[model samples]
Target: MNPALQGLLTIIIGVGGCVGYFYFSNQFLDKVLFPASGPNAGKNINRANIIRPWLFLLPALLALGVYLAYPVVETLRLSLTERLPDGGSAFVGLDNYEQMLDEPKFWEALKNNMLWLLIVPALSTAFGLLAAQLSDRVFWGNLAKSLIFMPMAISFVGAAVIWKLVYDARPIDQDQIGVLNALYIFFGGDSPNNWLTIPFWNNILLMIVLVWIQTGFAMVILSAALRGIPEETVEAAIIDGASPFQVFFKIKVPQIMGTIVVVWTTITITVLKVFDIVFAMTNGQWETQVLANYMYDKLFRSHDWGVGSASAMIIMLLVMPILIWNVYNARKEMQ
Candidate 1:
């Protein structure tokens, strides 16, 4: 077999299996095990109804445990142990953590990741909000939103390839190719600069890729939130001698703050795990290392499972607070 065919068959089998299980289990409960025609029919039916939901949910919970919870637990265990030279593993406690903390590259990646966490979510949200607000006023609002939101559909590697070309640099003697370099030369600059090779600025250029892709997601969500706002509120604000800026900032924005925070936290998670753009464009070279790429390098290139898993745990720790807050909000909403 073909790999694609095998995958298709596997998916078909999985779905068929789940459907068969549900149908047969429900039939068994209703007809054979707990017949609705029995003397205790009403009690049996109520019990069956309660148990049926769990029967359906059991497979999902098992899958989650096996696929998600298992890996996290295993990774934590691996992070606490180091592989010996003969391919044997030994418990090392916090040695891996100490080793990672000692590396300057890890620290560099940590700093860059922090900066990314701070900047990407904020900028992406801002650009998204601006696009959402402006596009709503235009006659071709849907078309504009479509164009703006189009980037979100592009894969990270594809987006990286597109941006790499945009940031490409050719010699001044030859025809300039990169847009930035071309613009630079056109405005009377020195030479075509390789943007990705530069230090802090290169990271900025890499971040711009994520920002571009994320802006559309932010825009679509915020646009919906904005649409949900009552027109009467805006009219009331206007009647009270409020400027457009005042209406947007004071009235509209306050109403949509929840959506904005949701967007922010959502993008924050993406930024924490951002790997593809940096990997495709720079590969964490020239002081541009981020936690994800660093973990990748440690796991594969250096063949250090201990350090890689430790880095993963760090990423998980960073993400935990947001997860808690989201769960808290969800529970509160339920109440």
Candidate 2:
């Protein structure tokens, strides 16, 4: 068979199989097993209802287990083992982690990532809240929101590329094409500075990209939460002589604290897994290393799976709290 035809057939069969499974499972439960019109009709129907959701969820659960759960387990195993010369693996326990800890670059990456975790979410949320409030009061609010929200739709790599020009450096002799340097020179600065080559500050510059992208996401979500605020509450705040700032920070914010936490954690997770921007901009140079970029370097660049997995596990550990919170929130909301 042609490869394309084979792939099409495979997809058809897989989808057909899932549909058939659900359809027949229901048929068996209702007709053969339950027979809901019988003397025990009520009990049979109750049993079928209890089983039905799990049956429908079976495929998704299976896929999640095999793809997500299994890879996680396998990566953990790899983190604890060293690949040997003859294609075998030997358990090295915490040796890989020790190796990573001993390295200066790993330490740098860790510190930088911690800084990113602290700054990105806070800044993104702040900017988002500002945009949300401002847009709400503007005549062309939707247009303003759309333009600000545009960055969220951009891929990280694309955003990185876009900002590359913004941070670009040129020799002192040539005209600076970068927006930052041009403004600096136009203001009578000595020379164009290479933004990404500056330590500590470079990390901040790189962070600007993530913030630019995530702020829009935060804006849209917080905007919705802001809109959902009861008009009566705002009226009451005004009646009490509360200032606009006080009304927003005290009345409006407290009401949407849960949504704010949701947005913060969501961005926090994104920051933990950040790589493409760093990769595209500085590639972890100039002390701008982040965990994800560090992990990629170890895994693929250095071909050291053990240390790589250990770094990945570190990221996973950092993400766990937010992940747990999200899961808890989702379950609570469901209830």
On TM-score, the leading prediction is 1
lDDT string for model 2 (164-193, tens) is: 999998999998889999998989999899
lDDT scores in order:
0.95, 0.93
Clashing pairs for predicted structure model 2, backbone only: none
Q: Which stretches in model 2 have alpha-carbon errors above 4 Å?
A: 1-14, 24-51, 331-335
Clashes of 2: 0
Candidate 1 lDDT by residue in tens digits, 175-285: 987888899889999998999999999999999999999999999999999999999999999999999999999999999999999999999999999999999999999
Query: What lDDT is obtained when candidate 1 is compared to the true structure?
Result: 0.95
Taking all chains together, the TM-score of candidate 1 against the true structure is 0.96
Off by over 4 Å in 1: 39-43, 85-88
TM-score of each: 0.96, 0.89
RMSD of each: 1.5, 2.7
